[model samples]
Target chain A: MKIALPIKFVIICSFLFLIHQIVQAQDNEEKIKMPESNNVCLNCHGHKYFSFYNENTEINERKLMNPYFVIDSISYLQGAHQGHSCIDCHSEDYGVYPHIAELKIEPKLTCVDCHDFEAIATEVKKSVHMEAFGEFFQCELCHDPHSNKLVKSDMAELVRYNNNRCLNCHNDVDKYQVFTSHENPQLLVTHDWLPNQALHFAHVRCIECHTAVTDTADAVHHIVPKEQAVKNCNECHSENSLLRDKLYKHQLKEDRSEFNFYKSFIINDAYIIGANKNYYVNLISLLIFGLTFFGILTHTIFRIIKRK
Target chain B: MSNTKLYLYPVWLRIWHAINALCIILLGITGISMQYTNIESPLINFNSAVSIHNLVGVIIIASYLFFFIAGIISGNVKHYRLLFKGLLNRLFKQGEYYLFGYLKGEPKPFHITKEEKFNPLQKVSYVAAMYVLVPAVIITGVALLFPEMIIEKFYTMSGIRLTTFFHSLAGFFILIFLIIHLYVITIGKHPLKNFKSIVNGYHES
Candidate 1:
């Protein structure tokens, strides 16, 4: 009975410790500010060319030398989860020096695991990626874990940030091929019909044209098919530019208006040919044109009468 | 000798004028088309208009350079010289003739001369149009074409937007000038006489 009591007590203590560890793991989520990742696992995993020895085959294999296994410490330290310990998300089995082979297939953490992306998921349901890629279309494909940052510093930064994400997959034929089975898909050739493609790409985000128009900026997740994309120039060029809704939608919360009457182009810094029409300027210009035309018409009548 | 005509429009000047006129017309059409790109009822396809506008802009730069160099070399630039003394008085007289005196068949307030090709009003108008507005558009156009060279910001506003505003405004003024020019050409001896003078390089003095 004495042996049984000690054993039972030990088992109870272990169960409590397991629960405490699980609770600590969850608490670590909030504890991370700018994760430095002081985790001991980084000693090997953070190496430029990390590899492991296969004991079963008695072969010195570099299986972990694949780019996926080696995390670039510089970028990892700069990333959102920079403060995170590897085990915070990864399986505890990873603590083993020569990790068990099955640990590789353990359900890995995804962006959605931490982020409340229910709104985005709803939008993504309508995306071509959802239909074509299904679950294979992950956030990491567009947003590389290492370099990811929600760029909101300025308009220029936002444009560059947004464009870089799209080009990562779209511009690289090798990477692009992985997504689409279409033979020989070239970004330039595909966009040949678009005038000044370079200029458009540099200034605007790909999602401006590719995504479905919605009130929320998260509508970016709803990337429509190419055919459904905005091809009409007037759609963005008109006074009621769709860009005001899509690309610059982030700046909507702030008062973009300048000088009460002066808005649109001056504040946004976009002088879109047809989109940034000034009401007062247009009215005055047209009035002058009308007066000049009328004056010419009346003068012509007088000249005709004098000659006759 | 009194009946002898002045060879006002030289070969180079004629060629420059023809090209400039054609470019202005094309640019005006394309500019308006680009500004009001109605997909449903477009005057010109947006891409086509942009291509045409950009191409003409380049040509205008070359054409203007030719005019600038040629005018200085040819001494034809002397005609643009203005005397500010009694300039407003002369301008008012010229304006009165066009508005009322022309209907009454009164003599012209200022006649075209070899030394003074343009009247007081014409001199000022030509100087403002050629020296002021045209160069304004050209500068702004070049800045817009190569935006990297422009100032990043003008006050709180973007330099690009301000440049576009200036370019568009200059183009608008040019459009108004073009209409007035076309109409004024009909004011000479015969409706088509001024037009023929430009082509044939002769003007009755």
Candidate 2:
């Protein structure tokens, strides 16, 4: 009986150990890399060359029916959805694709479905994008969910990135017409009064001038109309250059060094007239002025002393 | 001392001179401070300086227009004319008087007459200062005010930089001329004679 009881006790302990391991294994499964869970769906959707206008345009005049599904795996993995699984917002039925056509009718998910972005929505309501485009304006219009990073780019990259976002719609006629029937305005022709328009475009973001100056966190989205945009030279070409407050606002701490090619004002490589101040140049001018004044003084003293 | 009064200065001339002097002095003060601004110790705040500079710029342009139109209409510009024949010889003689003879109580180099308002050296310097430097500063100042008119690039430097350099250089030369102009007023007979004439429209000779 003692041997049998000991054997039963050993069996019970072993069973409990097995149960503990099963629970731990289940916990570990949930903790696996979220990207791996998305990999199953990516195998079918992930393609870099898969574009909206593909070779089969002649076959179907209608827009591609499955345009949304073609997510480039490289970009998807790099998106801000590091914590999101495919089923986080999408229906779990999507994970098991090629099975049911009924699954295709599943309602599309929005940013607010998973994220607590009520603040962003509130900001958009007050934005010019919403005011001009009406209720059709959404976050994904400007920010692509497939590949958006947090604010991490440096000043130069940020300029290019922000300007590109503006030009994507502004510089494209078809894209601009998608929102309104108005004829697209030519950028160069309209801005003929602005000097070095091309160079200005490369270094400065459009939002710097187009947007109203707001202390709000979403100041960028609050664009002003054409008449209201900053046109005054003093705004940028002064001692207190608004460039620091606008485009370079991100790098003020790191970029407060002495001016070089970009010195005196607006940019690092360009010399704006009002904002230029070189120590050596000023010193030489002052020395010449002082000597002139001294020589004048000496000449006057001579004329006075010689009047005998 | 010669005690004959001459109507060398007129009312229009006096008014123009007053306004021009005030505007130029203000422009010099504001312009120099702006060019050599020290963030820690600025003579004028940047915004205020630019605003003042612009306002003064407009006033100066108006004064210059008045001077130009009145000088032509009243035949005052004729005084600036110089005879190119023997001009160098006359200039040298006048230069010699100012340099050595004036202090020794020598006779005046060029007598003041209705037709001869300025001496040989005075004609040359006044013409250069009024014609070359004045117009140069005005054109460049307007260009700076409306920077859109300036070309994007010059030969090697930015058009704005070149414009700024020329503007400052011209302004500096004007400032120097002002000092010399004031000093030479003390040259003939009585030092305060010219100052009184500019203010009261009569030069005692």
Candidate 3:
């Protein structure tokens, strides 16, 4: 009886200890802000948001760094990770105070991580840059993934900005013998003598040739390559010039072409003309038919009444 | 078969039907014109035609909403809800009648009642056209009008392509139905009885 009592007591104590350990473990997980493995994070956060961000993938890690701390889940997950786990890049302190900001991580990826950039860079090295600058330029020199915006330049703006800039590079007098600045009084005086055959806007400015704006001030103006600008005849030509001065009569030209081509062309334009013709003919026929029927019915009734 | 005197068409129903029919006719014409824009403009002024087309589209939308509301309030929706009992079998039977028995002068398998005005064939076509085809076309039409909103979430090129195809396919189906509907109108007691009833809001029993 005595031995049985002691054995029962021991068993009870062991059960209590096991319960205590489980409670302690739960508390530990809740209290501390430690960086966990990707698995641990995923268990708490749903897999849907985290699936694409696994750390094993290859993306850029350099541009994603923060200054103070480095627990940034986004940067860590996005950087050089094809199938990486949370623990691969992040310190255990990730869940701690302002870990993401300390890391200064942005989620933009790098091409070198997924692709063989060395091969591409080798080919790029063989280009004119190596000959001009004696060194191959990196991707960051021409393009920044985080900041690259497509710059579209208008024609008028391109002309105004580029004239002086062009002279800086192409200062050879013989190269631009035909081209002179309107700012020069001599050129303006000479320009007045000729009947304005070319439009003022049609004259290509120096800025038309210059694609790059090297300074911060130029970016403020939203300047881009001149070719992207809208081009139409109305941008330059005066209404009076088109109405009378121009030798080419657009309407006359159109009518002449229509006469010659309408019968022979089985194109979309011809079909359009055919449909228009049909519409008019059908409309006129319908009107005549309706009016004739009404007129005849009225006349018959009148005649019948008179005879009666 | 002799329950023609049991029910009368309501004024609102007749007006709704006329408006709906007219809007559909206009939509069909405009949709055809838009598709073949390279062909000459049938309505003389381009801007006027577009404005009229958009106005007609809005009218169709408003009329559909009114129809739905009226159907629910009048307890007329009950006539549309099909009993599932032997539904597939009945559908097949109805299909067979249309395929073969219809040409043989056999009596229609389903009868119209005061409670249910539509026969099985009419029920199926009406249900398919109103619930499926009509809603599909409306959704596509709305998407086309406010493309920016719809494009934000589900903007796959394939999705847009499919929507366009379904819209045109609905047009094709409506064209087929219009021909059949016209023919059916001629099948009444008199050649012009159905047309007169629609216009005058009364049919001679």
Candidate 4:
């Protein structure tokens, strides 16, 4: 009887140990499970004012003031990347709490991963923004992946946004003076000749005048320095002006089968004086007319002398 | 002076000539002003020059159509008919008369008639200018008017550039023709005789 009780006791103990092991295994599985959605991350990041403290400081600053911080989900939902998921950009073990130290590396995400980096880089490398900022000239500096409404935005609004970005630094008189003094203060003085100088400053984007004339506006990002800027007034003011192709649409005839020479006879809704003017044609006509007038005068003089 | 008055130009023809001449002259002035606008004190301001040029261009086109229609209907096109059978020989004779004979005070080789209003040289030059040059200028000018309507490229050059080139070239020829026409008209019995004929529909035969 004593031997049977000991064996039963051993069986009950083992059964209890097996049940405990199974429960422990289930708890570990639950602990390591991945987050269902980005909400886990956004829970802490979505707050506009949320920020973590620097290693040196214990106080939390506004996210905008913190250079290293997460984007607010509220603003991100309204951004150009609204359709994209956080994992698309994060693309790492950010699914886990306390992401690995590598996530803090410079250029944690590269634009060239999804874009034509070579073409964009070729243009941007020449830009003053790239030259002045050096290592800080990143896509995110000008274009926030969150809240970026670039492609579908109105042209005027886009211009305003781009120019305002420039004004962020330029409007600071002391900083502007420091920047300009090192470059050329004469360029700013040269703009004084323009009619309504203040209006131009207020309305026109700096790149419009500072950049080289290109076939497409997108290529205007290939900016040149002050020395290479277009100085000729006739480039924009004369007939056959460059602005004709740049600012306006050059619509070809709908019928492409046969060439019709008279296709350009329709009146434009708006006219730029020198852009559409056929000055070469007019000049040749005038020259011929002048030659005839003078020729007649000379001929008459010769005939009068012969008569005499 | 011969007192024999020939009714060469009709009233409609006279009116067309006057209007066409005015439009051409105005277009020339405005065109020059616009082209050389950088020169101080232009004949007209830049904006005014463009406005006048466009306005006169339309008027010229209208007058040209009227001239074409009226001449066809009235059988006045016969005056411009080129007799190609002996055209080269006649042209030579007319050329000799102008270059040498007229300077020596010799009489013109060919006389004006209602049916054969233009001389041999006049027939060739006027026919080429009116039928070829005038049409070319008008077509190119109209093409330039609606830049958005045409193909962007013509062969190697832009449509605008090509049209401008042809329009200018044709205008140059017309200007030369006008000068020569004025000079040739003065070669009649009196200096102002041809001018008077266009105004009054009478020419001394």
Candidate 5:
């Protein structure tokens, strides 16, 4: 028993000693390299000795100032156009840090890059503001470059300008009054003279009385030719509501030949009439339909059992 | 005929019974949670609860088809036939007893046998729920899911508003019935008797 205990002790000791040697050898080996920096700034900032350095030259150059491209450089770097460098916009004489002294070109808005003034001018000429209403003396008279106050697209700037200009020409009694006697009445003071004559002074105009614009898009409307002017008039006057409804009924007519293809919105009576009265009857029909289904089921089951 | 061990249910019936039971429990929990979102669900995520309810609905339908086919093939249509016969009297009496007599410690009006496990009242209610309510709920749920399809066809053929109203009303009724049915299940001989029968496909004598 003594011999067996000593042998067991020797075996356990040898196993533990082997584990200790392995652990000691592992501890003597090289330690693992830690990350030099934590954030994205460190990705391009590490040196050969594993110290932090601002090694990306492009990033360093961006921090420096360039004179020739001063405005372009700041705006380009600060805004979404930052990905591009100074040479992209300020082409020649870009290498020198102080940059070559340059003449100031006219500052342009971002919108001018996509727009051609000549094309827009043609459309503006045919607009209501230019024709019957000389509200805008010219298109540029109302529109400004940077602030863009009156140039909000498709708004009723024409009506506002027209009312102001009309009052300027009509505020005097000489132009409108015919009989100036005390007993006699002026035509403008007559109760049945007009509906919106006072409203005109309150900044309402001809378009408010004669033309009904749908949205902002229709505020700046184009004048159709005399023959085609009848089409715009048809909106207020319909032939028959039922006749319009029957045109785009998708049931019997398998083909959509008569359907308005522009927005694919079925321009039916619902869109025009703006109210639906059939909902109540439809709900009653559905309840009746559900009841009828249960009735049929119970009847069939009873009939089969009776025959059996 | 003389054998004491009556093998009344088959493996398919057992499976259908278990799945149907699970669907009922799932629907009861999820449907209640859906009605009262302020209440904390035993399950996490209300959307997950809804998903479980839909999945359980599909499982119940599959199990129902299986049970229906088995009922036809096994000549168990007689069992359902008795449901229609004297249904009103049975339903009224059972309803009355539950309302009044059961409170006085009176015995149940009907007994369950292997052949006629569901009494007249039970069969009628089960058949109504299975054939009528289940189909109505399924149809309405399907219509709700594909509203645009129904609107496209029914707008000119019918009214979309009416279809939507019916679908919503049926859903409301089904949800109400689901709550009442769960409460009624608790009123069995013992509170756990119905639960045990559903789980193990057997009821105590």
Candidate 6:
């Protein structure tokens, strides 16, 4: 009975230890399981030419569907979603071979899922691109999921990036000519009155003129028709130009006292001649002109008849 | 007494004067309209005003060049030259004549001659207006036209702002001069005497 009891105790202890080990193994397996499954999906998709042909093509015809299914692995690794696992976006059950037809996988993940949707939505709502294209305008239209390297803090780069995205569609003059009435073959001719047209074209972004000045955070996005674009030289040439609010927001004085509304005019890298006009000088000149006019008027009144 | 005719303004000077006057009047109207863009003009729209202002500014500059060339070539420049020897004394006398003497029916302090067409005060004012003020206006106007050419900054202001300020100041002085010139023309022996003199290059003294 004593031997049986000891044996029973040993057996119970061994069974408990086995159970504990099994649980520990399961916990470790669960931790690594996600990455393993992700690699399995990447096995087929990671190839440079990984794309499925449309099976329903006629006997003589062949067509490829989802031609860009292959992800540039290097670029994806360095992308904004580098931290995220494939399952995080592809939430559907992609476990089975050839991914079940009934199991609908989201074609594209929404940027709103991770970003500040409200802020983005506010600016996007006012954007002319949205006005023309409608709400279906996906974030992917400008930003590529696998290759996007946009960083908001780097302003000059961000400006160049945004401008390049616009130029992608706009640079095709023949395509643009069909829709807009401004049929000038040379686009720069539209701004012929502006001196140093080449310099302006080289330095200034199209959005600076095409966009309406709005008090909103992203005024550059709120573009207008060419007809509605700002034609006034004073808009940029004056002491309080709209560019100061849009592009040079960083240079704005934090302390109100430090800001001289009259004299505080400067652009970051390049200089705009009229944009830096002074209000105090204008006022002083006006005063002096007024005094001179008054003096002349009084003098003229005193001269009437000749004395002997 | 028989009306004595004095050959005063030459044909080139008269033509220059007429064009300059027209340009100034148009510029003044357009300039004011441009400055106060919100106020609707009866004469022309804002865009038209700006276009006309620019056009008239170019015309005024051209006329100024003509005047300069004509003055130098014709020796009419002598008429505007201030006599430094008795400049202050003559100016005081002319000033007194305009201030009190003219009102009491006194004879004129300075008489017009071929070489000395302007009185001391007239010479001083004309020299300042034509030489200093007009050139300043032209430089500033041209600067405003081609802001890109400007060096971006002057003293405490941008070159554009400084130029614009000076341009407006000069315009104001020119406008005052025009008003005074018109009033003085009416004070001649006959109401239309000076007006006829400008038209036919002869003044009745």
All candidates' lDDT scores? Answer: 0.81, 0.74, 0.48, 0.66, 0.46, 0.68
Could you say which candidate leads in TM-score? Answer: 1
- Candidate 4 TM-score over all chains jointly: 0.51
Residue ranges of candidate 2 with Cα displaced over 4 Å: A1-59, A64-269, A278-284
In candidate 4, what are the lDDT values of residues B1-205, reduced to their tens digit?
5667789889999999999888877876776556555423556766567668878888889989998999899998887787789889999999988766877798879987766788899889988877888888788878767655556556644555566667767776776777688779888667898889999998786
In the range A168-271, model 5's lDDT, one tens digit per residue, is: 33343542232222343343664233322443223224333333233333333343333333222122112222212322223214445542321222322122
> Which candidate number has the best lDDT?
1
Q: Total clashing residue pairs per candidate?
A: 4, 5, 25, 3, 0, 10
Which is better, 1 or 5, measured by lDDT? 1
What's the lDDT for residue B186 in model 5?
56
**Cα miss at B119, model 4 (Å)?**
1.2
The share of true interface contacts that also appear in candidate 3 amounts to: 0.00
Docking class of 5: incorrect
The DockQ figures for the candidates are 0.37, 0.11, 0.02, 0.07, 0.02, 0.08
RMSD of 5: 25.9
Q: How many angstroms is residue B23 displaced in model 2 relative to the true structure, after the best TM-score fit?
A: 1.5
- How do the residues A1-308 of candidate 2 rate in per-residue lDDT, one tens digit apiece? 45698899999999999999999999877442446777776655664222232355444222332654677656555667756677776777775534478866766687777678776676777777888887778776677676655654544466777777777778898778899888888999988877667657755789888876765546767777788888875666666666656765655445666653244233333454445555566678789879878876886787889864
iRMSD values, candidates in order = 2.0, 4.7, 16.8, 8.9, 18.9, 6.1
Query: Which runs of model 6 end up more than 4 angstroms from their true locations?
Result: A1-111, A117-119, A131-165, A172-186, A189-205, A212-215, A218-220, A225-308, B1-3, B39-44, B143-147, B152-162, B184-192
Worst 10 residues of 3 chain A by lDDT: A267-276
Off by over 4 Å in 1: A1-32, A35-88, A95-100, A114-116, A144-149, A171-193, A214-218, A252-262, A297-308, B1-6, B100-105, B146-159, B188-192
User: How many clashes in candidate 3?
Assistant: 25
lDDT (Cα, tens digit) per residue for candidate 5, span B90-145: 88888876655655556778866777777666677667666676677666555544
Per-residue lDDT tens digits of candidate 6, residues B1-205?
5667788887888999899889989988887656544422234565577779889999989999999998899988877776599788989999887667766768888887776778888888889889988888888888777867876556644455556667877887777777677766666566688888899998778
Chain B vs. true chain B: TM-score per candidate = 0.96, 0.96, 0.80, 0.93, 0.68, 0.92
* Cα lDDT tens digits for candidate 3, B129-200: 667767777777676555333332233223333455566667656655555566555543455877777676
- TM-scores, each model vs. reference: 0.77, 0.58, 0.40, 0.51, 0.36, 0.62
**Model 4 lDDT on a 0 to 1 scale:** 0.66
